[model samples]
Target: IKTAVEKIDIDVPNWTFVAARLFLFDLYHRVGKSTHGIKGEPYCHLKEYLKYGKEAGRLIPNLGEGYDLDDLNDYIDSDRDLLFNYLGIKTLYDRYLIKNKEGNPIELPQHMFMAIAMFLAQNEENKQQRAKEFYDVVSKFEVMLATPTLSNARTNRHQLSSCYIGSSPDNIEGIFDGYKEMALLSKYGGGIGWDWNQIRALGGMIDDHKSAAGGTVPFLKITNDIAIAVDQLGTRKVAIA
Candidate 1:
């Protein structure tokens, strides 16, 4: 996956846009960790297939070569077996498990989850505890975030989709301000929920009665057009609802 990302061609604007979307939002949230050891909780738990391999009489190739014995033992120990439930185990294999270039599973469930947990908890002072807390939260149903939030929280891509507000008055400058907010939201891959209702209805008194107001629908169409023009890298979308 790392190789795929490195070699991915970003020349096509649309492709690049989509890649940017996933890179900042989807992939980051989904990936527990990279082999390079950057802590990311979102992508951490994508490694359950390796255990399946052991059950099939296949040892993870090159289990211990350059690593410390204690580290290897800690990583390879069967304690990870206790982390997941039956359904989570099955889902990990079916959807989330990442594989090597040769299609061999390179991730284990605990490693993957811990990697993602760490990524999400990167802001915490004690990363290990934060990662473990994240893992505990995700392991159960106490709290859950959307797929995009889950994918991109603590990475280089600060693609957090929550709320977008556009403040427009009755004048052109107000319209521009709203448009600017929309553009900013698009850049950050956030869904915009504009309160166009605040915009005065057409032919209504506004701005100390110097000018008439444009109705909500016309400005609504204009706002909609603005959204259409500025695409949000595909990770988030702007809609009326």
Candidate 2:
């Protein structure tokens, strides 16, 4: 992987694909040894993979239960794995694929895309067809999903929205509640847009007791800490605005 990555330059940018293939080879070998002992073929047992993810608590318990495993497995086109370049596949491997408690990836890029499609289309009238359509566009790189949707769609966390917007009112309870809400949302891969303009400026009066407020900077510092502490389950740091 190091050799292939070093070979990539402006003159030979396609080496990224070579590096991706090498990394994928290593990933497949690791997953196979850890799971089914079948190297070079990561998509061989779709049903078993889903079951293992559920048992490991990386995936929702009901994942793959409503679909025909045989059909879904057949629908998975391993050829689509070729669509991803190095950075794309690496990002998916690092952040999106479901990992066990031991922090090893249990699903491949195609598996992640298929799982997202299945979870999203599970409630449709013709769910099997809808799932196929979703898989087709996503795996082929014809559409892009938001970060949270890509990361949490098939996982037990399942908070698939991109971001949330809310206001922090100008009261003690409301300020703390806003902080708590941001923490919870960040825990599940959601970005936050908080309206803190209502907070008093520096040295403002607090109430009838003639207490002085420390202003929004102190509250903003708390939010900054929350962003660092709750880092979206290690996928990425929280984004706050």
Candidate 3:
């Protein structure tokens, strides 16, 4: 990236585009390694990658079980890599691209789009055509899925959809229960918006014993900690609450 940036500064304007290509290079290497144990070489039979992922249970649990992965290679259009701008491609490579155990991206730009499309069209009667249509919609920048769909679709532990916003009434048990729920959602890379309006103000008195309640601030304090505890893919430093 440093080298890519330096090239960008030194009058190689196309280096901005080249940076995404560099990321594509990394992705191809990862696929090569995963499918054939050979870095920097593409799999001669690309479907083997999906086959291996399913066999190893590293992809969507029952990926292409009834459908066919062979159609994937036929569907993927690598020319779409040119469609991305610098920031668009950078965001994908950094935050959304699926990675292998070694932290290498296994999906190319087209492959990622197709993976998401296939996952969405798995139950369709004509899956390949439906997947292709979906891929065309997204790859052409005509429409895009939610962040979670970009991040988790076709993944082994898919938690697709962007965020969760639900709440519970305020109380000792409710506050703690909300915390537990928030923590679980955050654990799976969700941004939760919990309603805390029902809680009393600072130093508010409890109705039962007339004791001073710590109020909403005290209850919300642990939220930051819980978010930190279960970071999103270890990228987002804390949960968005």
Candidate 4:
């Protein structure tokens, strides 16, 4: 694959494009053709993928409640597949593509772009139009959304923001409060960044010298524990103090 990829030059600019298509073919093979009730269709079908995926609990519940799933079919840019490099296509397929019950990729790259576009534009006044506009930008990779948006949008558990930054106050009560906040955010797949500056240094006095303090290290242990406990959706464990 590397050798083939390296051969891509001005003379053969589409080498990576052909490779990505082949890669997508392999991805389709790994999963079943579950487009709604039309199983094993031998081809990609966006609406069917959504209907079946939602029914199977692998997708966001009632994602297409009021929207016309068929409209999305028109917005998909089939040529966008040509834009992906070998690495880009592989990364997306490995990490982002929606899978079926059999663990096969049920949606194509274009379907994913449309799903995210519709999801983000769901609340807009002109949702259908907005979705198309959103799809245009994203499919072309002109503008990038945040990590969670890229990862969770248009999915069963749509935690679409990336990071949460809140300070854990100096006191124990405040620290625990921070823990609760972190837990909630982590549960919804957020990376946490807590302010530890408010807390005292190592071996510092605790509670106005009521007794010797374990300082930030003990508290940090708690933070570390939270990071491990709230491991974000098997994707990553995240926290930064």
Candidate 5:
């Protein structure tokens, strides 16, 4: 992988694909050994994979139940794996692919895409067909899902919204409540856009007393701490602005 990456330059940029393929080979070998005790074919036995994920508490309970797993498995084009560059595949492998308790990846890129499609189409009237259509666009890279949606859609957490905007009122209860809300949103991989304009500035009056307010900076510090503390289940730090 390192050698393939090093070989990538302006002249031979296709080396990125080489690196990705190498990385994918390693991923396939690892998952195959861990799950099936052999070097298994890619995109094979996806139903078993979903069952394993549910049993391991890595995926949503209704993931495979809502769809025909065999049909969905057939929709997966293992060739789509070739479409990803090294950086893209690496990012998905590191952050998005469902992993076990020991942090080994269990799902491939197509599996992740199919899972997201199945999840998003779960509420549609013709869900099975809708899921196939969703899978077509997503796996073919015709549409891109937002970061939170891509990361959280098929997982047990399932909070797919990308950003949360909230207003923080001036009072103690309101301010604390806003912090709690931020923590909860951040825990599920949502970026935060908080309106602290309502908060009092430095040296502002509190409870009709003169100059009792520590103001927005201190609260901002606490907010920063919360972002660091609840970091999207350790995938990445919460983005707060």
Candidate 6:
């Protein structure tokens, strides 16, 4: 794969593209004429794959009965497929490509890349131009979106970003309220930001002792601990943005 990537002189820097391409090449070699429901006669096997994808919350759209295999298979980009290198295709198939129940890849490597680009594009009017830019960035690995964002964006779920922000007030009740909000947001694997300025300083309030109140830090610590306890998606660290 390294040797193959070194051979191609495309205007890109990253090895991810090369790897993805290689993965696709291998897949094609292994199963060139494998009849997938979305690509051939609407086989039960392919339908099962598509069903599994939907059940797993994958962004792949289900092609109903009317959208036969011929229609789905017709949506091909042979030209784009040619652009993939050995490594680029392999990496895509291994890590990024969507697969069926039997572990056969449903979407091609180039198609996956195209889908990502489409999802990241600016808007309808400039979609083509912006999609090109997005493709370039992703193919070159200049910038990669978060896993969830990449996985779910531009589809029905359309929650494109990986993070969110919130603010808490100064008073005790307000502070707890803010924590509650943060907790809820964190449930969705979202990051949160809170301002502790409104919170009063410790030891200084309650009437007087205006000299030193220690301020906001304790509440901040408590929030941090709660975040730690709750955690983010069991994988990503809970973070304050």
Model 4 scores worst on lDDT over the 10 consecutive residues at 33-42
Tens digit per residue, CA lDDT, model 4, 94-209: 66777766666766777788888888888999888888899899999998777678778987677888877899777889989888888878877787777788887666776667
Query: lDDT: which candidate is best?
Result: 5
Show model 4 residue runs off by greater than 4 Å: 1-15, 31-43, 201-211, 237-239
Ranking by lDDT: 5, 2, 4, 3, 6, 1
Model 2: per-residue Cα lDDT over 1-241, one tens digit each: 8998889999999999999888888888877766775655667667888888888888888877678878888888887777778898889888888778788877888778888999999899989889999999998888989989998899877798988998998999999988889999999989889898998888778765354888889888998998999988788889999
What's the number of clashes in each of the models? 28, 0, 0, 5, 0, 25
Task: Mark the regions of model 2 whose C-alpha exceeds 4 Å error after superposition.
Answer: 209-211
lDDT of each: 0.49, 0.85, 0.71, 0.74, 0.86, 0.56
Error of 4 at 206 (Å): 4.6
Model 6, clash count? 25
Model 5 regions lying over 4 Å from their true place: 37-40
Question: Which candidate number maximizes TM-score?
Answer: 5
Residue-by-residue lDDT tens digits, candidate 1, 40-84: 433232233333333433323322223233432243323433444
lDDT of 3 by residue, 106-162 (tens): 656776787788888888998878888998999998998877678777876577756
Candidate 6, superposed: residue stretches over 4 Å from native: 1-56, 60-112, 126-129, 146-148, 155-157, 162-165, 184-190, 204-218, 229-231
Please state every model's RMSD to the true fold in angstroms. Answer: 14.4, 1.5, 2.9, 3.4, 1.4, 7.2
Report the C-alpha lDDT of model 6 over 75-177, residue by residue, as the tens digit.
4344465455565455445655665456665555444554566556535466655566666666555776675555455334454556776677756688788
- Lowest-scoring 10 consecutive residues by lDDT in candidate 5? 35-44
What TM value does model 3 have?
0.83
* Pairs in clash, predicted candidate 3: none
